[model samples]
Target: MDVAIIGHSLLGGPDPAPAAPRADAVHNRRKILDAAARIVADEGPEALTMNAVARASGVGVGTVYRRFGDVAQLFAALLDERERQFQTAFMAGPPPLGPGAPPGERLRAFLHAMVDRVVEQRELLLAGESASPVGHYDHDAHLARHTHVTMLVRLLRPSADAALTAHLLLAPTAAGLITHLTLGRGRSPQQLKDGLDTLLDGVLSG
Candidate 1:
């Protein structure tokens, strides 16, 4: 046993950190994702096939399949990339939305930022919800938003039901609700933002 341990140490312990992706692999992945985003943005989710992505990206269809596995997973990758950027912004970017703002102002900024998020990704978000109705509440993005809001609410209202308050605050930003209001009821994004501000005013004042 001691000899084995000594041999392992000589071989460089525990396998060096997993090697970074090959340069070509990284380049191909970016192209495929950019292509997928364009297809979804231009023609919506239904048009996003492996073949379509391949053509748009100028990569082979086999490469697309190997990289993303399937259309659903590929679409998910797109959402994941955009979600990371949004999370970074509110978690660490500037004041008002990121750090350093009072809980009230930070909460307000988050709700307003959510309005922009929905507007920018309306089609994708609606499609995701339609595909997995119950999963929305448990989604990584939703959980992040909920946790952020819950913390802010706790800070602003020490005696309030922060967890429940976070849920209530986020309810209006639901994709289905936003879609119904903006598309089904002719309400604009700005109107939605204003409504959020008004809602926050009441919540924070209480």
Candidate 2:
């Protein structure tokens, strides 16, 4: 897929600003998100409740509800911010993971980076995936990664089914799979990256 098309489709049109949000509103929103993130990090996704977040943030429950409809939406907002950062890193931040490297190298680097991300945020990501197995594929985070992988795959193998291949490549990196490998099998991130490199060797050389 064309990078521009992917950006447009995944990002959608920007919403109009509400005549500059109030400074207090902005401060409160950041406080809420930060507190919720800390709760999830220190405890777990199950610990992330509206009341818990309000208490942690020292904000009113009504304020928390007004900003984020529920715990799920709060998680989504956190994930959105994270995904945007990842997208920026891979799309434009640096070489190998970004625009400067050869496509084949970039593809390998991308998978390695993904392994790191999934391992680091395994619990939250698993929660997101568990919320909807199939619907998760439709998320902007997944689409952005898919778009990037498809582009690299096409460059590496012009005749390959880039979209399908991209999906296949990403399947192994799913949060559930990573959790199973890391927690269930006691595999390290380096082990996962090595395995991805082995897979890439065959796919790219084919």
Q: Estimate each model's TM-score.
A: 0.89, 0.90
Error of 1 at 163 (Å): 0.8
Q: Encode model 2's per-residue lDDT on 104-181: one tens digit a residue.
A: 999999999999998877777888899989987986678878988998998989899999999999998999999999
- Model 2 residue 44 lDDT? 87
Which portions of model 2 show Cα errors greater than 4 Å? 1-18
Q: Which candidate's TM-score is highest?
A: 2
lDDT, candidates in the order shown: 0.84, 0.85
Model 1 spans > 4 angstroms off: 1-18
Deviation in Å, model 2, residue 93 alpha carbon: 1.0
lDDT of prediction 2: 0.85
